[model samples]
Target: MSTPTTVALPTDMELVLKVFPMPKDSNNNGDIFGGWVMAQVDLAGAVLPARYTCGRMATVAVNEFIFKQPVQVGDLLSFYSKVTKIGRTSVQVLVEVFAERRVLGNQYVKVTEATLTYVAIDENGRPRPLPITELQPRRQY
Candidate 1:
């Protein structure tokens, strides 16, 4: 098989999660199931927001999700994420999943890309403000 072309991985995004799928995770077509990949993306996308939320959080929405290529078992999957927006009680993040084939050393395929939004929640599950700003050293102090 001809090697797939690759683009340089994002430098600005954080490499939040790196995982590989097992045989049980494969779909009928033998590719890793879409739902399983989405679940991993959801977990990866939350890495950045967790720093700000500093409390319970919930995934409020998957604003956009696109599977550009199929993933197969044994392919090394790398999830990169960046925070796109930080609201008073919510954060929007962009996640990109790349598949690195063992045969194609140093090459990566853009398998999936998604945008997700998460909300910081209080003990009762109501929206809560991000605790990040409060952690900054006060100028008045």
Candidate 2:
């Protein structure tokens, strides 16, 4: 088996979500299902864009997604995201997921990375212009 790649948690990106996978989230192999991870990623990826959109938005595209390591049950997952592009009505973000392995003394492994695009929407579910034209600096929580 290949060794899992250890990585430092991101300093520049905002931490959007933290979750622990339960046994129910695991597949037959005991690793967390990719679709479950993807769903969480989709939710995490929306966070940064929401700040700029300041309104309802929907994922328009998953530009890229890569799984670098498998997520095991009991691992604490942290998702970090940053806005990469701002269009007239869309915001693109890159999200990275890290798993803190308790079995390895809380070592962090980069498990997944994805790029996604979200479009601001009006009440009618049609695309609308973003509220902000440029990213505003904000304090990290």
Highest lDDT against the true fold, candidate: 2
How far in Å is the alpha carbon of 118 misplaced in model 2? 0.4
Predictions: Cα RMSD each: 5.0, 1.2
How many residue pairs in model 1 have overlapping backbones? 0
Please list the residue runs of candidate 1 whose C-alpha ends up more than 4 Å from where it truly belongs after superposition.
Answer: 1-4, 133-141
Which pairs clash (backbone N, Cα, C closer than 3 Å) in model 2? Answer: none
Model 2 global lDDT (CA atoms, 0 to 1)? 0.94
Note the residue pairs that clash in candidate 1.
none
* TM-scores of the candidates in the order shown: 0.89, 0.95
Q: Which stretches of candidate 2 lie over 4 Å from their true place?
A: none
lDDT of 2 by residue, 12-93 (tens): 8999999998999999999999999999999999998988899999999999999999999999999999999999999999
The Cα local distance difference test for each model comes to 0.88, 0.94
Error of model 2, residue 26, in angstroms? 0.9
Backbone clash tally (model 2) = 0
Per-residue C-alpha lDDT of model 1 across residues 89-120, encoded as one tens digit per residue? 99899999999987677579889999999999
